[model samples]
Target: MSSIKEVSLRRATVADAEAIAAVRVEAWQTTYRDMIPDTYLDQMRVEDSFLHWKQILQALPAAGDRVCVYVAESEGHIIGFASGMLLPEAKFGMQAELTAIYLRPAWQRSGIGRRMVQKVARTLQAQGAESLLVWVISGNAIARNFYEELGGVLLHEQAFSWDGMDLKEVGYGWRDLSVLMASVNAMPTSSSVH
Candidate 1:
């Protein structure tokens, strides 16, 4: 069995776009197998996702932009990634949004996700963000429970349209960055390779 000591997290660079996209596609295929339409999932291509992420990561951050991307790795191989930004629209006073997070199936439930999120939160807080929010597909109970376990509170719900299908999305909010930062800091650092 793989241990957390084998994993490390760091800022993602442009060269990582392809690996990040691959993980995104694979994770979506696995996690959203029944939650999303087969047609939509079938059309998800790594090349397309690579181009999208490359463009996003290549763009220069504007003034006050706190956009960041972090990748989790084990023995130099990318396993998971997360991206976030400080959004203008605030919900429950959360100015930061977790735009995307994905991990290969084999890497899930190993504390990597929590570490990645905490790192993102710390980066956002340093950029002057006070709170953060994440939106998950309503039926994705695994994600919902993960957020809840991290002390997130249900903030709101909205209708999302994808491939002509209407879907419900639930938003989870963390009103205090300090609380999250402290919790992350309290975790045993020895297990983290980085």
Candidate 2:
């Protein structure tokens, strides 16, 4: 495994689609293995998400839309990533939301996730967003704890269906970008927001 010191974060491009898809699939399989049905996770494939990420990276955001995608790389391999946007309507009175964040299981707790999140938060904050929120499947204690450690406040929780199974998800919101920014900044570096 590569050390965090070798990892770097930057905005993603279309060429990264395949690698990003791999990371996404791997992350889902590993992170949600227990929470989600085995059939769903087992059926996931990198090919399935490749075109979607390709389009996402290639398309230009429409007028007044703010979208950001960042990736964490080390040894030329994409290890983790995050995507977020300025919300058209506020949830928990926050103007931005972290739509997705995932890291290879090996990279977890390496501070790469912190740096990736910082990039996303800073990017949205620059786009005139004052606050942000992320949804965590309620049973995902690891993720919920990570968000809480970053000063996230529980804003909402609701029932959601997945593969015809009932599940719960909770929202963790940061009311102020500065607070989120500062909290991550204060932590030891070697990282990303993922």
Candidate 3:
């Protein structure tokens, strides 16, 4: 395992699609193994992930949504990643949802995840978001704790179908984007008023 001290965060590019895919696959297996079906994971293919990553990197976000991808690199190799996007909503204000965040098992607990998340948050704030959001698997204590430690609050609980099975997900929200940004060493500013 590479040393976490070497990890640094930066904006991802279309050229880094493959590296992002690898980190996604690793995080999925480790983070969602229990939440998702074993059969689904067993049949997962790197090619599919490659295609997905390419698409996300190549396309622009739709409607009210915007995406920003951040990668953590160590010695020129991507070791972790996070993707944040604005969500379409009617009642809530502009929200930056942490669609994905993952670090290699060995890199976990090394502040790499926090750094990756901060990159996304800062990017979103720059894009004009006032709040950030994340949904953790109901049973994922590690993720729940991580979000809480970062000052996220449980907003609601919802169940969704994935791979033909019911899955429980709990929404955790950051009421103050400024507070969340502060934890990441960011000096927060209000996004553009629309």
Error of 3 at 46 (Å): 1.3
Name the top lDDT candidate: 2
Deviation in Å, model 3, residue 107 alpha carbon: 0.5
Which prediction has the highest TM-score against the true structure?
Answer: 2
What are the Cα lDDT values of the candidates? 0.85, 0.87, 0.76
TM-score leaderboard ranking: 2, 1, 3
Q: How many Å off is the CA of 12 in candidate 2? A: 0.5
At residue 187, give the lDDT of candidate 1: 57
lDDT of model number 3: 0.76
- Which runs in model 2 stand beyond 4 Å of their true positions? 61-65, 190-194
RMSD after Cα superposition, model 2 = 2.3
Query: Tens digit of lDDT per residue, candidate 1, span 50-139?
Result: 999898878725423488899998888899999898887886688999989998988787778888898888888888899999999999
TM-score of each: 0.90, 0.92, 0.86
Alpha-carbon deviation at 160 in model 3, angstroms: 0.3
Compared with the true structure, what per-residue lDDT tens digits does model 2 show for residues 38-67? Answer: 999999999989999999888735523499
